[model samples]
Structure formats: structure tokens, C-alpha cells
Target: MIVAVRRSLRRALLVAGRDLTVERRQPDGLVAALTFTVTLIFVESLAVGPVEARRPVIAAALFWIALLFAAILGATRSLERELEDDALDGILLLAGGRDALFAGKTLALAATLGIVALAGGSLALVLFDLTVALPFHLVLGVALGVIALPPVVVLDTLLALRLRARALLVPILALPVLVPQLVAATQGTAAALSGDAAASLGWSGMLLAFAIAYTGIGLTIVPAAIE
Candidate 1:
């Protein structure tokens, strides 16, 4: 079992490295995600009307909106490219197994979304005067959001592709499942801003638990979906 686990991890890394290399060579997804994030932050800030002065929850709301959409865009593009080029079958053929392919794709999706979240979060904080009493908590909230959200997106995208479902259904399918994560991350950020220790602790626990759960689900289920 230990050996199998190690092999899976190594295979995942190789798959992830291949995806990363492809992304670097053709960066449409990366460019689109970052652009969407920045645009969402700027436009949403205006809609909220003065970030620092708004309700504490506003900051969390804005950040999550950008991060969520950014992640969606990246995941969608990654999968769409595969389907259009029929590269997914090639990936599976080369990957040696479905588990490795899932791991690699999950890592790639998460890394791209993570970068956009961190960049957009910093910019949103400055634009909206979203100064929280517990800045560390705010940072942690963002980190966990990236960690937990990607697997859900990747798996859903894969499932949708398997079903030949429309692109619109991806969010429709994913959002219901993503609620716990979205609520946890948003409320956790609010708690951090307000210095609510109890809320922070609870939400943080939820975030960690959900991250682990979703990642495990991705590994366990995506292969089945592919097969």
C-alpha cells in the first residue's frame, strides 16, 4: 500500500509537470484567468461602493466571487482544450492510469487558481481598504479557499465532459457541492476581519476538512468517471 501510494504521488507529479509545461507553452488559460480576476476585483469594488466602509462580509464576498470565477475559467479552459483537441485520450494513454491523470490535472488547476486568488486578493484588499484586525486569518482563509475549491472544479469538469453536458452545467453541478466551501471561506474571512475567534476556528476547521475530503474524492472518483 505504501509503495502504491508513493507511485501514485510520483505519477501525479509527473502528470502535473507535463500539464504545467503545456500551460507555459500556450498560456491562454493563465492569461484569461488573471484578466478575469483583476476585472472582477475592480468592477466588484465599484459595485460594493467603498470596500472598507461596507459591511465586513463585503470583502469576503468580493474576494470569493473573483476567485471562484477565476478558478472556473481556468478549469473550463483546461478541459475544453483537451476535448477539442482530443488530447484527453492521449493523456490517459500516456499517463498509464486514470488516478495519475486526475492528480496532475487537479494540481495544475489548483496552482493556476491559487496564483490568481493570491494576486487578486492582495489587489482587492488595497482597492477596497479591506483592512482586517486579523490579517493572518484573512490570508489563511484565501489559502484554504484555493486548496479546497480546485478539486471540486476539476472533478465536475471531468464529469460534465464524460456526460457530454453543456459547459453551463459545470457550475450548476459544482455550485451546490461547493456551498460548504464557499460559505466557510467567506465567513472565515469575515470572522477574521471582525476578530471573532469562535467563528474563525469553526470555519477554519471546515475549510481544512473539506479540502481533504474533496481532494480524496477527486482521486477516488475521477478515475471511475474516466473508466
Candidate 2:
């Protein structure tokens, strides 16, 4: 049992490392995503204007909107990397099978999205000139949301690969799966910033549940789907 687990871990890390290395070598995709996210936040801040009375919810929504779109774009590019040069086929032939590839890709996707979320969130704060009562809680909410999103993003992208209008369908399929996450995140951030600790706790619990459920589904089915 130990041997099997160790082998799996090793192969998964190899897959993730390779992907990260490729990303390091060619960073245009990351740059594009960051640029798009920053531009979106800038435009939103201008529209909302600098006002002391601006609602925390508005800031939360704007932050998440940019995070959401940037995440989708990033996830698409992540999958495309595997498809290019038939790299995925070679990956699948590695010792741990499809599960290894899925595991590594999921980790890479989650990490990449997490970094983007942090950067975007920071830029949103600066753009909106916002202050919150519980900044740490807001971050936790975003972290959970990011954790939950990449699995669905990976699965749905795979499903959409065969579709004719994949670009539209990716968001269409993903948005509904993402609703619970977005709602929980938005509510949690608003509640935290408003100093409603009780409300924030409730939303955080929901966000954690959504993360666990989606992650389980992804790990269970993604490898099978790939085959």
C-alpha cells in the first residue's frame, strides 16, 4: 500500500513539475491573464468611482467577477498546453496512468489560479480604496472558492473539448457549478467586511463544503473521463 501511494505521488509531482516548467519557459499565457484581470478591475473601479459609501458587496462582486473570468481564461490555456504537441498522450503513458496526469494538472491549475486570485484581490483593494473589518476571513473565502473552482474547470473543459461551441459551453456549464462557490464567497466577503462574524462563519462553512464536494467529484471521475 505504501509503495503504491509513493509511486502515485512521485508520478503526479513529475507531471505537475513538467507543466510548471513549461509555464515558466513560456509565460505569455500568465501575462495575458494578469493583464486582462487588472484591466477589468481598473474599469470596474472607475465605474463604481471613489466613494466612502461604496458598498462592500460591490467591491466583493467586482473582485470576484475579475477572478472568475481570469480563472476561466487561465484554465483554458492550461488544458491547451497538454493538447499541444500531443503532450497529454505522453503524460498518460507515465507509470500512474490518467489519475497521475489529472492530479498534477489539478494541482497546477489550483496553484496558478490561487496566485492570480491573490494578485487580482490586491489590485482590487488598491483600485477601490477599500477597507475591511476581517481581511483574513475575506482571504479564506477567496481561497476556498479558488480551491473549488479548478476541478470543475478541468472536468468541464474536458467535456467541452469535443463540443462545437466549446468556448460558450465552457462558461455555460461551469457557471452553474460555480454558483454555490460565488455566492458563498461573495456573502462571506461582505459579511466579514461588515464585521458580521456569524454570517461570515456560515458562508465559510458552505464554501468549504462546496470545495470538498467538487474536489471529490473531480478526483473520482476525471481520470475515468480522460480514458
Candidate 3:
């Protein structure tokens, strides 16, 4: 049992490492996600127009919204690399099962989205002049939200793998499922900014719950769906 578990862990890490390495070499997805997110935040900040009272709430909303779109775009691009190279089958075989592949993809995507979230959050803070009253909650909210999003995105990407309009369907399918996380992240950030620790914790807890649920579903469904 120990050996089997170790093997699985090794395979998962290998898969994740491969994906990250490819991303390091290519970086198209990362570049695109960051550019889009930064641009969205900048444009929205301009529209907010020097309104200090309004910046907190609007900044929270805009940060999460931009992150949401980044998640979709980045995940789609990451999955597309496998399809473009006809590598999905090979990866599944090497990984020994779909669960490990799912896990590795989730980890790689989580890392990618983490960078985008950090960039977006920093930009939001500077551009909106947003103050973080509860820094812990704000960071926790972003971390949990980033961790929670990738599994759903991976599953959605695989489900839409054979679709004719995959680019369109990916977001359409993922947005509804991701609304809870989005809401929690936004509300949590708002709470943190407003110095409501209780509320921030509540929303962060919700984000954690959704993260578990989404990742569990992804592991359970991905194997069957991929085959």
C-alpha cells in the first residue's frame, strides 16, 4: 500500500512538473491571462473615477471577476496544449489512471492561476487604492479561490474536449458552477477590506468547502469522462 501510494504521488508530481515546464518554455497562457486580467482591472479602475468610498466594494468585485475570466482563459489554453499535440492519451497511460492526471493538471493550473491572482490583486489594490483591514482573510480568500477554481476548469475543459465550440462552451459551462466560489471570494475580500473578520472567515470557509467539492467531483468524473 505504501509503495502504491508513493508511486501515485511520484506520477502526479511528474505530470505536474511536465506541465509546469511546458508552461515555463511556452508561457503563452500565462502571458495572455496576465495581460487580460491587468487590462480589465486598469480599465475598470478608470471607470471608478477617483471615488474612494466606492473603491473597496468595486475593487473586490472587479478583482474576482477578472480572476474568474483569467481562470477560464488560462485553463482553456493549458488544456489546448495537450489536444494540439495529441498528448492526452499518452499522459493518461503514463500516469496509470485518470485520477493522477486530474490531480497533476489541477496542481499545475492552480499554480498558474496563483500567479495571475497575485498580479490582479496587487493591481487592484494599487489602482483602486484599496486598503486591506484584515490581511489574513484577504490572502486566504485569494488562495482558496485559486485552489478551488482549477479542478472545475480542468473537468470542464475535458468535457468540452470533443465539442465544436469548446472555447465558448468552456466558460459557459464553468461560470455557473463557479458562481459560488466567485461570490465567496468577492464577499470575503470585501469583508477583509471593511475589517469584518467574522464575515471574511465565513466566506473563506465557503470557498474552502467549494474547493473540496469541486476537486472531489473532478477526480471522480474525469476518468470516466476522458475514456
Q: Tell me, by lDDT, which candidate is best.
A: 3
User: What are the Cα lDDT values of the candidates?
Assistant: 0.81, 0.76, 0.85
Question: When superposed on Cα atoms, how far off is each prediction in RMSD?
Answer: 2.0, 2.2, 1.8
Q: Rank the candidates by TM-score, best first.
A: 3, 1, 2
Candidate ranking (lDDT, best to worst): 3, 1, 2
Give the clashing residue pairs of candidate 1, or none.
Answer: none
Looking at model 3, residue 41 earns an lDDT score of 81
Model 2 accuracy (lDDT, Cα): 0.76
Best by TM-score: 3
Residues 1-227 of candidate 3: C-alpha lDDT, one tens digit per residue: 99987987787788889889999999999999999999988887777665842556778888888888888888888888888867877877754668888888888889999999989888888777777899988899889889888888888988898788999999999999888888888888899898999999998998889888988898788878886
Question: What is candidate 3's CA lDDT for residue 93?
Answer: 76
The whole-model C-alpha lDDT of candidate 1 against the native structure comes to: 0.81
Once superposed on the true structure, which residue ranges of model 1 sit more than 4 Å away at CA? 51-53, 94-96, 162-165
Clashes of each: 0, 0, 0
Clashes of 1: 0
Candidate 2 runs further than 4 Å off: 1-7
Question: TM-score per candidate, in order?
Answer: 0.91, 0.89, 0.93
Off by over 4 Å in 3: 1-6, 52-54
lDDT by residue (116-170, candidate 2, tens digit) is 8878888877677677788777777778777767777777876676566877889
